[model samples]
Target: MTKTILITGSTDGIGKLAALKLAEAGHQVYVHGRNADKLTSVIAEVKAVATGAAVDNIGGFVADFSDLNAVRKMAAEVNEKLPKLDVLINNAGINTTASVMTKDGLDVRFVVNYLAPRELTNALLPLLKKSSEARIVNLSSAAQDPISYKAFVGQERLDDKDAYAQSKLALTMWSMDLADTVAADDINVIAVNPGSLLNTKMVDEAYGEYWASADKGANILTELAISDEFANDSGKYFDNDIKDGAHGDARGEFGQPHADALDKEAITELERQTQTVLQSLSA
Candidate 1:
């Protein structure tokens, strides 16, 4: 069964590698990014390495996840195009040195790293449910261990640089919580800390022109995506830092237990709060 796998931010790094790897495994992969030019190159690379895979046209989507309006439009369009999705990889995120504000009046890190993934996953829930076993993989980080307050939504009034880590923490929390909610439906929502890849362009953007790649980091992501054994593993974090198992620190102590504690009341409150905010903003 060649399932349809949708990966966000596949223009580079772990996401890009995941796309290529899944394609090689004969899955229909849809690669997404904010820039068409970047996505064009990604599609080319994926096709080159796809071996004997049963891939589709290699979808190229351009929507900056930082923008709410853009996210809504993307959800609508992607929903229409894909009636059923087997996997949804929430891999698009950013680590910026300076804080920026999106059009929706939310912190850019919160929007890109956290809110966008939440919005997109919510919008695609219906399509995901259509499939027998759906997997939603989120790209989380061990850096989210402490789950800092500075990076939390609106903690800093749009100037704090640590928002990146904070937002990642939020995403990890959400992934765990969502997993428990959808587990009964057989929809596995898991997050993995793809470890630290060496020499990737993302490092160059944040650090400098030179940084050593995590010799084994490149292959860690693919393991989670393509491994049949891990196919049913849900609500767990992959510590790319660890070779055999998920890094215990990726979600910190609050991750799994926290998600386990999310009752119907909590989920309803969260949904209401988020929907109110989104509707207010859109209005």
Candidate 2:
């Protein structure tokens, strides 16, 4: 069965590769990017690689995720264009930037990596509910650190790594909470650490080195998006970096998430702070 999938930050890296793969498999693939030119080019590229029938199924959206209002507008556009979304992949993230502060005075990493995705997911919940089964794959990381509420709400400042790690942890925490909140609706929410340092633009800019190919991460994303193995795996975290004796191999299997991701106290605190931030944004 062909599925309708939307992948954010899909103009490049694993997100783009996954979009191409899904499009080739005849799924209705919606690719998103921050740049309009890039989005147009990627849509064309996906269409080029897609099979005969799937060629017409490729589409795209453009939004600068650093701005919450932009994310909201993009969500409205998505709701207008897509009747139902079978899978939503929150793949856009950043650890290195020319400026770390958004115009809203929040850390760029936090706003783009966590807050924007949260807002987008919530805004699209109704459409997702329309599907018999829907999957939400949040891109997490192995670099999670404890979230500082002051920093999270922009009261305090943090360096790039600190902010990025906290943002990912916050996202993972929210994923677990959201999974339970929408369990009755059969909307599966899963947090995924694609890999420690796969060969992606973000990794190259941040670490200058990679341990695996981006395809390794894209493969797991494609699986989680449609494979039946994860039908009942909501609220779970898939760590693609953990496989015994597969450390040097790029094709390692997935494992459980960091202990903090499953901690109720931490997750509750993250939810509380996230709500506070969202409310402040609205105010």
Question: TM-scores for all candidates?
Answer: 0.81, 0.96
Local accuracy of candidate 1 as per-residue lDDT tens digits, 146-255: 33333333444643435666567667767777988898888887776665534567656766653334334446555555567677688776665553344222321213
Q: Find the candidate with the highest lDDT and give its number.
A: 2
Quantify all predictions' global Cα lDDT against the true fold.
Answer: 0.70, 0.89
Say which candidate scores most in TM-score.
2
Tens digits of per-residue lDDT, candidate 2, 147-255, equal 8888987889998899999889888888888999999999999999887788889999998998888888898899999999889999988888777332443444456
TM-score, structure 1 vs. true = 0.81
Clashing residue pairs, backbone N/CA/C < 3 A, model 1 = 198-213, 198-214, 239-247
Q: CA lDDT of 65 in candidate 1?
A: 88
Lowest-sum lDDT 10-residue window in model 2? 244-253
